[model samples]
Target chain A: MNYPWPDIGTPLDQVATPMPVIDEDRLAANIARAQDYLDSHGKAFRPHIKTHKIAAIAHRQVEAGAIGINCQKVTEAEVFAAAGFDDILITYNILGAAKLARLKALNGRVPKLSVVADSETTVNGLDATFDADRPLTVLVECDTGGRRCGVQTPDAAAALAQRIAAAPGLRFAGLLTYPAAGGAAEVEAFIVGTMALLAEQGIDCPVRSNGGSPDLFSAHLVPSATEHRAGTYVYNDRSMVRAGHCTADDLAMHILATVVSRPAPDRAVLDCGSKALTSDLLGFTDYGAIEGYEGARIVSLSEEHAVVDLGGCAAGFPGIGAMVKVVPNHTCVVTNLFDRMVFHRDGIVTRVETVDARGTVW
Target chain B: MNYPWPDIGTPLDQVATPMPVIDEDRLAANIARAQDYLDSHGKAFRPHIKTHKIAAIAHRQVEAGAIGINCQKVTEAEVFAAAGFDDILITYNILGAAKLARLKALNGRVPKLSVVADSETTVNGLDATFDADRPLTVLVECDTGGRRCGVQTPDAAAALAQRIAAAPGLRFAGLLTYPAAGGAAEVEAFIVGTMALLAEQGIDCPVRSNGGSPDLFSAHLVPSATEHRAGTYVYNDRSMVRAGHCTADDLAMHILATVVSRPAPDRAVLDCGSKALTSDLLGFTDYGAIEGYEGARIVSLSEEHAVVDLGGCAAGFPGIGAMVKVVPNHTCVVTNLFDRMVFHRDGIVTRVETVDARGTVW
Candidate 1:
């Protein structure tokens, strides 16, 4: 039942292929760089742990001056809270009786636990499960151009805040918006308008939370935001590089896949595929970027094989059994694909961390 | 840590949302149907365990008369083999020293274990790891219009078979082809020609393997195929339905998701997203099909939310907290998403099984 990892000083060729690897140096640099940016901007940085799902990395972020951690699901937050991340924000509309009960239990355990809700049903569920003695803090999620989940307008946000404040077991804490990339102006306007409406209703909006990794730097533009939340900054990816957020050097995680089959000169198949790297294109045409193979692109992915077309490569491609590092299109999704991830320092194994919160989607 | 599911006979509304559920009767019917087709065709059936990844379901398939199981990776096969699946065919080119050693160990433990390779590198690795004392059987993967992994021509397949035959610790079993759907003609021509070529060289070809759920019925067209491998048919999905292989009633698995946010009249965001339903569109534009909402189309997906466009629904859509079942575009990828799947018979929970090979990509 034990899965083996290469020893610390073992060569890359000796390590397992199609395994997720994190460059320790690059990871430290990415974490420090992100924290520095938020510190200089005077924003409370709450890095989403959904990116890595590894407690060790989350602990590193906390040590690097992160104010809190953000999780997408209640079960995911439980993993972090159990690992001593006291302040956590579950940025999703949690419903269902079982989940609400779990959330209330998690809220009691964590020192600071906040949840976002765009509708009254979510608010009511939280209120029904939590007690007035240990009131749950609820944030009204706003549709600031995200067009996914949220109250449609600033007015709706204010209305939701009123309901949260009136609920016996809930406290209206803030206005939260996960805006679309480059939608800072809209986020600012929406939050400012909602806060004004809440103020008129004698409700104070203490936290104005805004997020989106693609718009991480431009977060300062939204002055109404008291804190900022973003994931994927801790381990930049191909989508981030294409979004001009970071360069290839900033990518800390890669799927170390070996060329298992070179059936023809043009076609070489890697052991990593949708099951290993994930199928989230995130606006990218190719599945991932093969490091050192400049022109080579991952043409397609089946469940367990990434078929790469070597026709586009200007330089020579790796032969069979030769390992290649693939920067996934979206790094966060790839983290959820595996049960454990290997950490490396200059191609040498450092640690193998279990993805503790993986499959915590419920 | 305890994820509660609704007890037997409990209403569907009471079960946790965003969970994968299986209809026991439908699953049994699907399995029996596929087995019957292969039985009538006089071909040995090898159901791929990658679709369900549950040991119990795999055992049922074997009990229903499957000759063996098909796994995509060595680690995946290990999970099945350890779970009492004595015969297995790993239809992948497994490389790396660690994996080769594991494969050899697994081969010794299992009564019948076979692997496929389309290149000399894979064959050499298998030959080096295994010995004449425990000789390994290898099938030459044929392209057969799949354009993913396989030797190009019959001559190449013949040459590879000759190489495998001459190897010190390898046995040339036959040919394997994961052909493009509806490409039975190509598979037949390639296999028959390769068998003829092998015959001219005094090499006997025992097994001609052709696969894919879409072409399962048409497998009889390939007269040279001794055994057929398929995965998705046991839990028929949207892709299989769209491919004209089955109907909605045949689908056994569905992602049970609750409407968490009704942000607008046209949009309803479900708790399930790419993390639950998967992003494997499998040529389908939408993420999944909501069972009763005929016009509803999954507009987009983030990590934690499935933004469903309710504009198309002729039947009234459910309000927030109301649960709905979603048929994922690709069931295999969806199976890899969740750790446990709930099985039900007559709307009553029967059992909850862990996805034994959920993250066995390596």
Candidate 2:
């Protein structure tokens, strides 16, 4: 609640174990890398705000050449909108009266409000919500490879987009899809195929957008995609390292964790666990990595502590009151868990930003 | 983020859709069942507050005859302290200067601040920060089948407890262990075994606590356990249902989500995913059940949308612009993701409490 406690009283140092420490300089560099990539690609960067879920970072991103911010939920968009982002894109399939109500409310505030929808049923809902007076711009999402959402066939995509246009309150804006890593070719084919289908039906498709940090480098090859969304470039994590996007040293955010117990000679305990780091079951076995702790994998996670299991090879970890910077498996969820994060630049405390939309779980 | 955003400003009917909705009445019943079990067992119910992370709920738990609240982090304990909780037991291996500084700050507020450590390394850290005057309480955490933190042998437990007592500013309280479900015999043996060693060493043992929700129903069989810390009883989840702790209806919390997309004829998508409900990395395949969809499993989850593999059962689902409820595998992690949650009695919404210590990453 009342963070950093006021007591914990003064400041902390490298020895100050167990608090998320963001190396601001590294964060800036991570941000610059994303900017440089987008700049090189000549693509509009509407980074997903859901990743960092920090208004401060979002503002910095906008300043660094992002066209706007894309959020996964209306609540997140609303939080960002309230924090003074004029242009916001909700990169989610909007549905229902509740979602429409929030969208209407948000639409009144922000200058540009764009949303993506996959099905005709969602289009009808949008039609009912927006009517002829305020025509809602709808984008048909295609499930190129990630069989999560969107129509499969190009004909289905065209039909869905035309159906949205046929609705009194909804108009076909373009095509939108979120492809998985190494999905640029697939996304390009889907967009091209869907656009050709729409053109054959005498319907025009303008905006084509697709994005993910791992694929951002290859995004330039997809000429039809005018907009790109990437979230993790600002705070590169261990996954980014594994993905070959960045080196481990390039990561900006690191969980400054405290070692509580070395139960065995090998197992060193840290105060961060699923509760803090989040159990984002991201198809992984670990929550994070304790820097310098070799052969140690975060084997188990309780709500409080991450049980680091070191089989055979053991090192004398930072004794009892030792603090180690842990680079979480994923940085986005970790940032979303906190209300405020203290920034550090060049090993000196810079500033703290309130994660204004830390939790808008609906 | 202002939640419950409708597509067209229509309020949702609480009963219209299926989800893992928490019935306040059911929650009361569940709490009653737990307290009744502890009362029948003559054990103090010091609920592990990690499940709820809400101070109001914790206070309500205390009002319902709880001896105190058992927290796992100094941050969690600080929240309870701020809420005017006098005595709090942090059942965690607290470490580092930053955390100890926080504990020292908490010591000034809460009268009784007890923690557990299984090793001399951990106890020594306690001795370092305790300021000597505060007199922090420590307990030996013995491994009693959970295979997590804790000393492996009772002899080691006694040795650690002695080391804790001998360490300046640390007062050895008793023995603590988190037993695997129905592992009371192991807990009893450890406590008795450790106590005998303590007596042989001219030591006095007072409190002996064993905690874990699944074992609450059968905890008293461990004759040496005086208190129990059970968190999930406050808000049972889908995992608890699968674990035989509660019925599906006994769950006290649900993600209020809107059906944003109908990606396929059979598959419908909801707006809540790993971000809202949390990807708790549960062993189960289903994210949660679609409230009323008989045998419908949410087979896949992305960051935002959960692709419900409807199995050619589209006719059973609600229209596109509809709201639906879904139960998450783990409720505790989901609760930790939010700052405040609106409570409802019947269908009418009521109060909102700041999840006072929702996201304490440290």
Candidate 3:
């Protein structure tokens, strides 16, 4: 459990290469900006902790006026719950007996714990696990445009909500949808239709949740959504910048790496590869972007070496032993790769926080 | 760390979804097969622990006649070393003062420790850290055909080897190359030429190492290489099967996941996603190959959901709550994503071993 992090107040140069570092100043600003933007629209903010997976960062988000936090897995919620956070929403279909047992226990401890279900199987499992005296809140997951999970149509969503409401140990909490990149209009139509159907059935829906980092600022576009959920906004990445959601200046996480080998005039190898960065391309051809090295492309990634083609760069390739900062294509995946992340301000280390929920994918 | 693993003799049906499981019979067979194959060719075998990152598996490889263990990072080697492993070879350029200090400490404890270097910056750091009384063994890494973290030519390797020989606290060991797929001729040529140059310089080349799982059975092609190293052969993956190295039966590792959603007849969603199975496509278009379900493609993966397309399957898609096994594109990266791996025999749980170096990327 000993993380390879330098002491507090240590300079960035003294820290090891291929390590995840967060700019404290930028991190605070990103959290505050997102909360302020959501507050302006009178929308409740529930920042997803999957991006950082650190309890301290989640505390900052809650302190910045977030109503609750979103977790992807049962064990991830347990981490933050142990760290003293109360409100948690797990936006995943909780299946199987084992996970249901854990989820029931987590619900017993947390004040307001909510989960989403898209099918009868998930609803049955949740109903079978909870007791009548303590009903677990359930949200119907609707697939508006994102074709990953959730019910196909608003009618299907209304049916699932009725099923949840009829269950003895489950209470129907409104709707949840992880929309496609620019599918706000579709999300709005689906939620509106589902709500109308529920009205006809005499079911009162309270929470309407919608989220996606690619369309964070435009979350207000979905007028029916009451709360917003987002994970990637905590640490903006190359894909966020490409989506025009956040600029490079708002990027908080950077992989500090050393140029270990210069095998060719146009090629250099970095110590940070797929293990340090991530293989999640997020629609980018290259692995990541070098901060100051414009046009340099990460051609390929071995387990521990990132082969960069410096041919596109107007400036020459970095010499061996030189250090470079790389902005990962997807910062959330990068956060899960490490056990701890170093927080810094103006290139000086402030503290190191353990990624408590890293590898808690189950 | 409390990993979500079931007890001994637990049924596969009882275990949690999105968990990495290894068939104990197949794992033992893989270790024995690779050892016998290398033994028949009169070549020493060094199993890279980066694939499993478990001491029990490393111990099994040693019991199966592996000469030593190979590590990619200093902290990873320290993990195996603490578990009673000696004679470790770290195949990475040891740069920076902090890592060199660690390398020196590891070398002091291990009976025999070696490292690779392709630049003077690495060699100088080693020389500055170690004492002359107990010099560290250094190998010159040649690029051969794998254009990553190595000298481009035999001459440059020879030059680096000579530089290591002259260093105060370093001993030149030999040459090492991680050849490109099917690039045995280039590897042989590079090693032969480098040995000749070292002979002319009166520098003794004791060991020559060459390896890659794709070209594992063709180790004899590089006759100059005294030893061979391979990691993925221990748990053959989809990429290894496509490379004609091992069959589907040789794939020991699998992500046991639950079918959480069946939104469309052609589309089913698995609980496992990029966090369970890696996103390393290698050269495959799909994320992974689903066992028992031919022509099913894992079209996309979110952090917690794997959207599968069963359109091409002759059989209908699996219903919600059904379990499926996934063979990842790259097994090594998959191993890095989990804290513990479940070992089973004939669909019955045997034990769960901790991935000791799970996140020791530093």
Candidate 4:
């Protein structure tokens, strides 16, 4: 696509630098790379739509050979499923009556509807909402390393899988794992130990799904992994850079914000603040990644302005009328902040895509 | 206006309870109360549009005796100004070349255009952007206890005001203060002292703007104040409640979320998270105000779900299916996150007002 801001030029005195800017080139390449990996590995690449939360990106993934999209929330799945994606796997434990009702409703529209369950309560909630005829496929989540939510051990896993199989409105699929950072060994140990036990019990184990972007490369190390779902790899951000996955230039999303104020000698402000980049440092040292600028801490943030304190230490301030590029600590949350993001290429902003699920909130 | 969801009944099952909830009765009372105060006060009420950023609320404000609306960013002002609010005071220092081009364009459309300047660079940036025929009015920001911006002394204020008045594309309108919490005396001292110094310089100061919801009641103490602009009174969040300005029930904006997971005993996860509530604690202790549950420390927040640890919990959680309301810690940031917030009347969702100025990043 032809870019709109082709004439913007290279930093002619900062036009407006606080809002995020999306680098379309890196994003396309990342999607292609992930697709290539999926193709070679004989594994289904069901990318999670939560990271982008934009239907445009989802459509792009489907075009890039993604089997489907994985959603962290039922509401998110509802959003993507509504956006014409035929298949979606809800990765989180889908509990509660209202959510189950929504999930049961979602099953008819979506070609494939699968969910992960860790405990009996969640399965019970799912059972109450779903019908026996339209049984929901259950993936037993094993707590390999990352201890957010899952059955603690292989025995706990087997018990849950058994419960799922025995349940009227449920069908046990297989083991699932959201791998711990670099804990491929743990994932391997858990899946190997559990599947063998299940085989001894004469239970069939077909699907083995795992996800999370931090250790996307480690998926190959995880034996018996039938599929992998990752989100952040598509639009690598500052967090990805911090995680040693991508470079700052490789980042696809840039908050195209304006430097609104220069409050003091060494102080500059961007129209983008916590509302734009968000204070989700995501375990990073710096507030966000501003490609060229260094020694600038995004010290203060109101709803609209991000006050950058240069500490009177810059070689020279980028003048008051400068447009600055800011990489949010957490790109996904920042994307959620805005209703639409202006897509730019070759120094021009041409298309503005609506974050249709911008604030679905429920 | 009719409400959505349950009016009165047993709490929702499997829901993450004590989330952000809007109290309809108190919300109406807050609007009327703030409107009444602004109406009765001598100063013109240009209730800051940054609070809600909703045109419906702006329309409501216009209906409720607001002379104009004070918006911090150009896009925010554009929303109300485009909606036919003839007068608008964009309080932030609108810097940058492209933004200036946009601001210059805006100056022609809006009948009255005013902005703030706390630095010399900003004054000049404004000078470069505006036209000579219709110079933009500059409000010299005074450091009234909020040490973020503004001139330190009255002489400094007089000097900048004189410079702004002398600048080709700028005219010093008056003084502005976003005071520290309960810094009315500081506003009074700065105004009186600055006015005295300006008089010594034989300069006429036209606008004296004092703002802040925490210090809204004390605004009358600044006798020469021309206007008062406050945003947070629209949604009296947990921070406001802690500031003693509002009770918990006075909150308006609530996150309508469902419980997705019940991982363990005394732990449930709600759909609303940092992407919704935002990380702006505003110095208030708890994450966000959960009406009936005071002890529920919003222990964890991801992009999409708020993991509330009800371990040493007080009020029991609502059921999984319940749609609980959450009074966010900082309402302003919360407003910036979502595209639309469903207004409720008597617990029923009434209207889906567009956040017209949303994602107007640059």
Candidate 5:
């Protein structure tokens, strides 16, 4: 498929509809704000690259004093590693022989590569893949009330760490948890307890990673975590705004779309739909929020059309051919949908970057 | 990003996890079934390419006796047209100058290219782009109880048809609609009224296109509709089965994923998540249905992890590293997420096809 990305100097109106755009000023501000906040709290910052999947954005984040980057998949980390990004942490359980072999290769390419494991099956796969010549760093993932991809208790986490320390080809690094929203207290308790248990077993725990965009500002509350990770902070979305983490002004990315059809006085359809703006409701009834159109709800979405209910709005409905900007419900999934994103400053196109790891889901 | 699509003849177990697999036997059977059903009703079958977006499958549909192809976007149509498809109908309102220029070029390439318009603004854009030397065929899009993008009334549809016929560079071909589910009676009434209005104005109405995968087998009920359009029938999904359009055995596409993490006794995480399997619930409580696991539910999804709750299941939970097949709630959105799809017959891989129009949203 051919993507007609606009040139560097093109204006936003002439670029195209149903295209993802990043505001350069807002993106820079977001990266700097998160880095400064984490730095003031004396925590290492590792921005997750799953949000943008662009090496340029990762470079910006690193330049803003991020300690490293966090990836979710082996193939996704391989893209950043090839682009000269070292000190990467993959916050996913690496299981199966095919993925373990690729993880070993990625570890060899980068200066420091680490992964998380919550079970003996995953740790065994990692231990069998690496050797003493180059040991792989493995972090024990604790539940911490997240109830997703983590051990139930701190005892299970410490047990996994002990097994990791005993393996010749693995190092028991520390504890990691992707906690539920507003669960910073539980996360700190889980990590602190696991660290105390590891100390009793004579295991040197180094990294304690905690992550969630919803509770990014509350990282200081979890004082035991040495490093903090976040992805959606770079692109504040409708979900973030609703969570009070960031206001609408801090949103860096917006889907530029055109009003292609207005079937009724109460309804208008945009060119962007599930293919451009994803179906991740993130608890919102609407797909996204349209800028300058308060009370307008994106009620439904087909493959390439978003139906907007214009009733109960103070503002008049946009006529056909008028362009509108939509702040997606979840910006990360929207980033994965497009091949390239147009970066702009003050409505002037700055650059167009290809999503390097757009479809590296495995 | 590098996608390690498996080689031909690779076993299903050898192929990478979190990859979309198409059962070739089921896919062929689906295409033949839809075509034969539509043929038996003496209605033309214009398969929508947005579901699969692969030229190979489109070729298969054409060979199975589809009259033409239906595309939702101009660039999407360009892909099938480049692959030797002559007759194409883009069922979208092609607005804006950038898209209209491309639409004119596409019309010049294909032998029979048509488009739908509901407003005078869209028709004027089309009329201004093309010349009378090579006129463009335009169909009036009627709402017909589907409140997405269409004229609200039959009178409005006939008015647009008259405007198209009066334009020097346009031809009022007929009427088109994407009706609501089980809206055959409403669709027939609307199209019949529009045709009568067009007949009173002495306008020639040759084509009446009615489409919806949920009402695929009921095409004969809408006797006025000359052709039928359905996309998901080619790859039946959970929603299709729930709608009683096809059985679960007719589902062709499945996400072959590996159990990556078994953190708890009653919970397991699959490698496929919102990025691989889409976040589109399609009114289902879970993301997808696990084959052979009757009571297991995919409770939640992250970007790269699907947390499955194995509670109350008659069958045992899948151990870590065990492979499972999942029928997605909606197959069309899943196809848009991946760069390539694997095809197999009887558990042996046959081919891998790149989604040609994967990110051609604009």
Candidate 6:
């Protein structure tokens, strides 16, 4: 599997198509902007590495003033930990013996490790794997209208936090919520109610984590949050653009695809399909947005072909062998599709980095 | 990145969840049935390797009477060629210099290599890459109705065939079409009209390749077809079952996921998210079908969480830490999401094969 790696300064057309190309300038601007916003709000920014899944990018984020990295799985956190990141927070209910063992090993390797638990079973699992010698911080995840993966009410969150504190080897860290976008007030209320219950139980809550890239700018509105976690804000996508979180110029990642087939006047197919661009619609009507083709719409996708309807384009469709850049609907899922991505500066290849934490879902 | 590979005879519960498992018996039956259908129709079966992307399974298809394997990309074909497969058909309009060079090298390694071309640019590109000493066969792709990638009309198909025949170092093999399923009449008419036009130009059409998994059993209805290509029929999925192509019992691939969180009585989230199960809707209302949970529907997916509404289950909802099997909406795309899959017999692990061409999309 010897792929053709482009030269240090080779242009994009000279390289391969249907591959991810990260704009270095755009990446730096995005990182600085997000960090600046959080810093001005007097909150800690713990960026989620699950979006980029690259150790180099994670290191850069940390160097740019990120407090730590947030991972959704133990294996993903392990990759960043092995890459020399000392502080990590895994935001999932990790279960099973195989994973618990890995979590224990990861806890030993990192100086600070935090996990989330919304149920008693998950708290017990974490307690069984760790002890006072190697304490593991557990955060109670509250469902603030996200309708997924969290306790239903504030009372449930306080109860879980109390259980974590009662269990040996487990320290109740704080409250975390991945609330629905535009639900900042709900998150604030949820955090306040949960902290009140914790106060009555004589428990001290140190951290309040609120996360979502869509409402990142409004994070300050939630007064109870001390830390914010986000992944997609680093590389805004078509969904982010539509949500008004970022504009097209802020998109750092794009799929460089060649127009391989022009079957008819209205139809042109690109080499990038589900395997390259991903199928996460993310509420977008189309799969992606072509840079210059304002009117073009990606109608459908097979396993290896992305069929674009060129009838809507104001400019004529591209000819065969012409390369085009596509902004995928979801950047995080697109990052997981490829094993490696090329970072470019002004269309010149600079470096190629592997997605180290990709496919480590367990 | 050392993953936990289950030992031989390891139970499903002992292995990590959210991984693909292939049932050996069902796989064998699927292969036998599809091959039998094509054999009885007097058509050569060239199973597409894009579905499984494993050399071991491609070898089994060849052993079960497949003439060759159909690949969607040159890099994918190279993986099969390195694994001792000599005859291959890459059903993509390969463009760009980097890819053409790789194609030439692959042609030199394989005894028989054919590709599809619907435009003159593709034909000339193929001609420029090889000479008469190392000729390449080209198939004129006809747009019968699939509307993805092919020449618009039979006249265009014949014209492209004529151009391919006149080009040096290229031989016009025959006519090919990836028509809409149940489009036997359209395929027959397109092939007949193209053959008539080619005959007027004093040309011979040797192979007529018709492909689709849904209408595989109806392949014989199109008498002009000499060969049929299909990939998903070997590992039927939710889409195939909904298409009336196969039953749930015919499905051979299933994702083994663990119920990691029970946020509420009506909602249970599995570890298999879009990263593991894929977000390919494929016209299905739900993401996947949970075995024995007749009423359950996968409501949504995050990067590491598959939130399923468990209110519809006839059987009781799976408790936290419970292992469940899920049949994905599109099995082929789901196969590309994983690096390796476990093969099992009667719930016992037998072999674990890497998806050799998993991300070889050039």
CA lDDT for candidate 2: 0.76
> Could you tally the backbone clashes for each prediction?
0, 23, 0, 45, 0, 2
Provide TM-scores for the models. Answer: 0.98, 0.92, 0.98, 0.88, 0.99, 0.99
Give the candidate number with the greatest lDDT.
5
lDDT of 4 by residue, B188-252 (tens): 88899999988988889988988888877766787879888888888777778777888766777
Query: What tens digits encode model 3's per-residue C-alpha lDDT throughout B239-277?
Result: 998988899989999888899988877889998888888
Q: What TM-score does structure 5 among the candidates reach?
A: 0.99
Which should have the higher lDDT, number 4 or number 5? 5
Q: Cα lDDT of all candidates, in order?
A: 0.88, 0.76, 0.90, 0.73, 0.91, 0.89
Best by DockQ: 5
B271 Cα displacement, candidate 5 (Å): 1.0
TM-score of 2: 0.92
Give the per-residue lDDT of model 1 (tens digit) for A1-362. Answer: 54656677776657777888899999999999888988999998899988999999999999999988999998899888889988999999988778888888898899999999999888888878887899998999988888898898888998889999998899889988888843778888888888889889999999999897887888789998989898998898999998899988899998888888888778888989899888998887889999888688898999888989889873499898898989999988988988888888988888788899998887
Q: How big is the positional error of residue A11 in model 2, measured in Å on the Cα after superposition?
A: 8.1
- Arrange candidates by lDDT, highest first: which order? 5, 3, 6, 1, 2, 4
lDDT, residue A56, candidate 2: 85
- Tens digits of lDDT, candidate 5, B9-45: 9999988989989999999999999999999999999
For candidate 3, give the lDDT.
Answer: 0.90
The candidate, 3 or 5, that scores higher on lDDT is: 5
Give the per-residue lDDT of model 2 (tens digit) for B1-362: 44542222223364222223445676788788898888988898898888877777877788888899898877778878888998899888776555778787888788988988877767777888885777888888888888777898988998888888787788888998888643677788888999999999988888998887778787878878888889887888777888897888688787776776676677777767776777774578778766788556788776677878777466778766677777778888877766565555564544556677777655
lDDT of 6 by residue, A59-175 (tens): 888998999999998878888989999999999999988999989998899999999998888988888889999899989988998988889889999988889999889989899
Q: Model 1 off-target regions past 4 Å?
A: B5-10
Write model 4 residue lDDT over A129-165, tens digit each, in one string. 7768888888998777764566778888888888888
The runs of at least 3 residues in candidate 2 whose Cα sits more than 4 Å from the true structure, single-residue gaps closed, are: A5-17, A131-134, B1-21, B128-134, B312-315, B345-350
